[model samples]
Each structure stands twice: as C-alpha cells, then as structure tokens.
Target: MHRGFFGLLALGLTFAVPAAAADNLKITGDETVVTIETDDGVVDITRQKTEAALIGGVLQPMVPVPGVTPVGELEVLDALKTKSAKVVDMRTLEWRTKSTIPGSIHIPYTEVAMRLNELGCSGSQGAWDCANADKMIAFCNGPACPQSPTAIKAMAREGYPPEKIFYYRGGMQDWVVLGLTVAEDMF
Candidate 1:
C-alpha cells in the first residue's frame, strides 16, 4: 500500500465529547483507556474502540422518533390485510416516482402538515375524510429515514391523534429487500 494510505488512516475523525454530566466515568487503565458512562454502564474505549468510534461513532443504535411506534414489514403487511389502516408515503417527488408501497397515499414529508387537510385528518375539511381510516401510517426510505419521522412529528404538532398515527420505519428499502410487491408512482 502507498504511504499516503497509512497517513490517511492515521488522520483522526472528530467527535463531540460532552463534558462529564451526572454520570461519573471511572478510569482504571493507562492514558490510552477512555471510560464513558452510558445508560447501560461505564464502557472502556480502547485503541480498537477509538478507531471504531472514528468510523462509527459511540456505537449507538437507531432510535425511533419520539411519540411514534416503529413498525416492520410483517406489521405493515398485517395492516394492509386488515384494510383498516391507511399507509402514506413520506418520500420525495423524485424517489416516489420510482416505487412505493402498494395502495399507499402519496404525501411528501415536506407537505405533511399542510396536506393533513387533504387527507381529511379530522382537523380540516378534506375530501378523503381520515376519520373513516383506522391507522394513518407513514413511511419513507427505511429505518434510518427521517422523512416519515419528521412528518409524524408534524402531524403530532398539528394535534393529530397519537393513537391513530403509526410509523412504518422499514419503508421502501425493507419492502424491496423482503421481495414485497411495489407500485410504480403514476403521479
């Protein structure tokens, strides 16, 4: 390998290190060891961990958006079968044109708050009348997607019923990954 590659590897990635909070970190090892107090417990960051942190950051997992339930493919499948739920797409215009969940309504994340009336979500005089719809599920790309979460939050802020709103976190990525049927967006 070229010497430049080694030099590039040695370049450290920056991470936001918060000051010691209510949690106390106990350091027992040498200068190389870094102890961080997490909710689980104090974890030691060794040389290996430091490298990993640079690549992946503090090793945190995907957390669901607050005030919304994270659902998977099977759950969405059941929802579709029940015919009581209304699955909405929160992706962009370009991405939505490629593919989307079959029978899902297209309401981009950016328009969620404004389009609530068009969805007839009980607040405005929309022709759709969401009152007849059981659960209004929203989804985007996948678990890492922020569109659906942001839309769901917008709905909540608009006083949409928490019980009626659901978040399908798996989204189109998981839907395609699991070989589920997809509908090409005609709109």
Candidate 2:
C-alpha cells in the first residue's frame, strides 16, 4: 500500500511541476509563448501573436488611435503636479470607489460628450482658453478596456479638439501596478 501511494505521488508531481513552471509566460518579439518541460521533452505553446506587417524588415509599435495621445504614469504624475491637465476618470462608479488614480474626476464615459463644460472646457467649442492648450484628459480600466477611448471620441463629437484630448491608456491597471496612490473617497 505504501509503495503504491508513493508511486502515485511521484506521478502527480511530474504533471504538477511542469504546469506550475509553464505558467510563466514569455513574450518574444510579437508572440506570447509558453514553454513547458517534462521527462519526455519540452513543449512549446503559442497562445497569441500580434498581427503587424514588418516595415523595412523591422517591427514597430502597433498603430496608434487617431486623435488620441497615450500618456504613461510619469506623464500623468507630471500633469497632476503642474495642475496642467483636468484629469477625468472614465470608469463606472463602482470601480471608482474601489480604486482610482489620485486627482482624477469621476466622469462616466456615457456622460462625457454632454458634460464637456462640466469637465473643464468652457465654451461651445469645448474651450478653456483659446490661446492656450486644452487640459482635458480621460482614463478608465486599461489597454484592454475601451471606456477611455470611447469617452475621447464622445468629446470629439461634441466639437472638442482632438489635439486637446488625451488618453491615459494604462488607467487604473497601470496605476496600481506601479504602486501609485489611489483615492478612495474623493474624485
């Protein structure tokens, strides 16, 4: 009985060990690959590959969204420090309450088009200062999410200048990932 139990334990470890190791995904070039090692051999599993045409035999970042500037954590931090940007949170009320980038105002994506003035743009042109730059920026969950991008488009439809609008593509995901401060109560 003891010999059979030990044999089964060993068999289980063989399968479990490789699975745990393979959970470490590798990103090489534009593809996501999972490499697993077992007694028999190594197995390569390709989960996804980004589709992009090689330009001059070299890879480049994916095509950017038209009329949107992607801002990183550093840029957002700078903008907050200077008070240069009117940061808007495109997340829903639930997500905002849980955690959000500090200093971003709560503006659900659905209301952005009509609430341009409320967000900071003053006039019918969505103008704060005609002579100066636009400071309105919006963000939501992250890259895989569309809330922020949708809000930006809504602003554009409301006659907001594309150049004035900014998109914090990383949003809450990147903010927390970088250990940035999150505001729970205030917007």
Candidate 3:
C-alpha cells in the first residue's frame, strides 16, 4: 500500500508541475520561449525568440494586412443615403433572408462566380473598365471573415476592374453594432 500511494503521488506531481509552470510563463515575452518534454528528450525553444514591437511604447502585435480601409458603418449608411454607391451583401442566402442593409443587393459568395455578368459592367468587352459608372462595393459578416474578399476577387477575375471594386470589410457586424437600420425584407 505504501508503494501504490507513492506511485500515485508521483503521477499527480508529474502532471501538476508542468501545468503550474506553464501558467507562470508569460505569453508577452520578447522571446516566446517554449519547452517541450517528450519521452525521447527535452526540447528547448529559446532560439525562437522574437523581437516584439511596441505600439506607443506598449506591445501591439502587427496584423496580417495593416491600414486596411475599414468601411465604417457611417460610410455605409451615407452610401445608402446619398445613393452614390451600390452596396452588395455577400452574406449567404439564409443570412440575407434574416436581415441586411437597406438598398443593398444580395449576392451570395457561392453564386458570385456564376452570376458575374449580372453585375451590369461593360468590362466584359475584353479590357479593364475602371471608369464604368456602375461601381460596386461588397460586404459580408465582418472584418474577420473572408467571404467579401472572395466575392471581390471573383468579380475582378470576371472582367470587373479592380478600381470599381470596393471591399466593406467592416461588414454586417459593424453595421449592427453601430445600431444602423437593417431591412428584414430581402431586396
């Protein structure tokens, strides 16, 4: 019974020690050092030290694409008000059915490739038409989502000029968060 109790204690200590140590390791370290212990050997990650940059003297990690134009909710609302731009909702049909921006066109990302011609652009004439009067802006769920980018890329590949394509990366989440009006009826 003494030997069994000691074995159980050892087992508990083996598991608890690592977890307790891991909790103490700060993720904000200049060198994100990681130590891994395996049955084979102990692996030290000291060489993986990364220099962290300070934003205003505090650590601020860089985003994948910095300075991305965040189409603000106010901009979208203004677009709707002024009727200066065509807002296309790239949300899925189910999402569109639930709610969307008023005066926005519904075009699901899945169907964008097939319905490229319906965008009413003259760029299909075999040259990029950045000057086309029918400019289009795409929006999806939000900045973290990629559906709007996919739709924009599809439009560009289908002869729509890149200049005419605007991405509203802030998307529906920002619109709703800003308390902007939403149309429950599909357009």
* Model 3: ten consecutive residues of lowest lDDT: 53-62
lDDT of 1 by residue, 99-122 (tens): 888878888989877777755565
- Give the distance in Å from residue 6's predicted Cα in candidate 2 to where it truly belongs: 38
Tell me how far the alpha carbon of residue 90 in candidate 3 is from the true structure, in angstroms, after superposition.
Answer: 0.8
Candidate 2 local distance difference test against the native:
0.64
Better by lDDT, candidate 3 or 1? 1
State every prediction's TM-score relative to the real structure: 0.60, 0.61, 0.57
Evaluation by TM-score, superior candidate among 1 and 3: 1
Off by over 4 Å in 1: 1-66, 123-134
User: Against the unseen true structure, what C-alpha lDDT does each candidate score?
Assistant: 0.64, 0.64, 0.61
**TM-score of the candidate numbered 2?**
0.61
- Taking the tens digit of each residue's C-alpha lDDT, what string does model 3 give over 1-187? 4656347556674332333333232334343446788554675543211222111111112221232234566677777788777788987887787778889988898777666555665444334443453666778776545677766766666666666566776677667777778889584
lDDT of 2 by residue, 1-187 (tens): 4646347656774332334433432343444455688665676654321232111111212213466676788888888889888788987787788878777778898877656777556665444422343676777776555677767766766666777777777777667777788888554
Arranged by TM-score with the best first, the candidates are: 2, 1, 3
Predict model 1's lDDT versus the native: 0.64
Note the residue pairs that clash in candidate 1: none
Error of 3 at 98 (Å): 1.3
- For residue 64, model 3's alpha carbon misses the true position, in angstroms, by 11
Total clashes for model 1: 0
